[model samples]
Target: MKSTGDSKETFWKEYEKLPDAIKEALFSEENFKIVSDICEANGITSDESKSKLMKYVGKTLMGKLPIKDFFVTLELEMDMETNKAKAISREIDRKIFSGLRIALNKIYSTNIAENKIVSDNKRNKDGTEIPMPSKNEYKDPYKEPLI
Candidate 1:
């Protein structure tokens, strides 16, 4: 198990190992514009929306947060409707997640060809495997109650 600082350092080291083109695409203005469009479409005028979106994007990129959790966070923290949040998540998946997946796959294949250790799972600082949230834990905000 590593401390938070150690884990962050390791993450940054791995991030730096990625190709320059991949890094550039990950932080490109197009991606930023997509986030801004989402905020603006949802009538979120506050700068906080952009800040929170970027924060979640960073966590998602680092594999510290799941996309589902990002949707939940956006719905809760930004006062967004569930459908709007889900649409935003889908847009992000289409625009950002696909590119990230391709880049990661390329990196993974290269690492494998070089016989480098590739971790299959992310763990907590205590060395425990990070568990996915149950459906009950992430109930849809707009879901109707059962009779």
Candidate 2:
């Protein structure tokens, strides 16, 4: 009965507008090495793999795991020397940043889209479902019959 704009999009967009520092630390030099090395070693270097890794890191961030602990887990998969990983981190910083940024954007976008779609379902004030009329019915089931 009321319409103006999509609130879910606005909420996520507001979150995206925050300073990079405040954003979830989904991007780290250590994370990049862990992911890139594994993907390369498995001959699976691809955007899709990066996306999966991003989701993994994003989950860790959302879980509020300390940054240091996150790298420890990542190293289990990567195993690059600390010094080498740190240096390699700088070299691939741009790619790592871009991948993370894209990953977060996709995560937020899908989350908002799914929520908006779920919210579109019509429900009673008491949250009871109303049965719908069949196609043979004269009136639209989704709408109340006209007076």
Candidate 3:
């Protein structure tokens, strides 16, 4: 696996190749919600919270950083602006991760899906085939009356 810094670098390199509309979407408010939730959950209150979170956009998508740790890192990296942010609940945590995953997929769906298709084909090539289901396994409970 690549080092965190390397993965982050890779993320930015790919990020730069994205269209301007995608770049705008990357900074969109819904995307920011993931970072905001992470910060709140980890008790990181800061005006710069979102900006700090932005720095790891690449690492998170690259899987170099766990989602929670990504937030924790942001918390550690940013100066706090307040202490009133609420802790993230488990449900909220799920939602935040779901949202991030969706957003990242939207941004890199083609590349991500291409990799998956290639890997799946390789695995199938190297593995045994699954058996097809047998037909006519069940018997009818009642027979029709003879004319």
Q: What lDDT tens digits, residue by residue, belong to model 3 across residues 74-146?
A: 4355433323222332333465445556555554565556556432222246586545435576455696767
In terms of lDDT, the best-performing candidate is: 1
Candidate 1, residues 7-74, lDDT tens digits: the string is 88987887787766557765778878888887787676688778788778766665456555878987
Q: Which ranges of candidate 3 are over 4 A from the true structure?
A: 1-12, 16-25, 37-45, 68-93, 99-147
> 105 in model 1: Cα distance from truth in Å?
5.8
Which lDDT value does model 2 have at 133?
53
Q: Could you give the candidate ranking by TM-score, starting with the highest?
A: 1, 3, 2
lDDT of each: 0.75, 0.52, 0.54
Give the clashing residue pairs of candidate 2, or none: none
Q: After best superposition, candidate 1 residue 145: deviation in angstroms?
A: 58
Q: Worst ten-residue run, lDDT, model 1?
A: 59-68
Displacement of residue 43 (Cα, Å) in model 3 is 6.0
Pairs of residues clashing in candidate 1: none
Q: Which residue segments of model 1 deviate by more than 4 Å?
A: 1-11, 17-22, 104-147
Model 3, residue 2: C-alpha shift (Å): 24
lDDT of 2 by residue, 11-109 (tens): 456557544643645456676566677557545467775665555455543433333354444445456456544443343334444545554455456
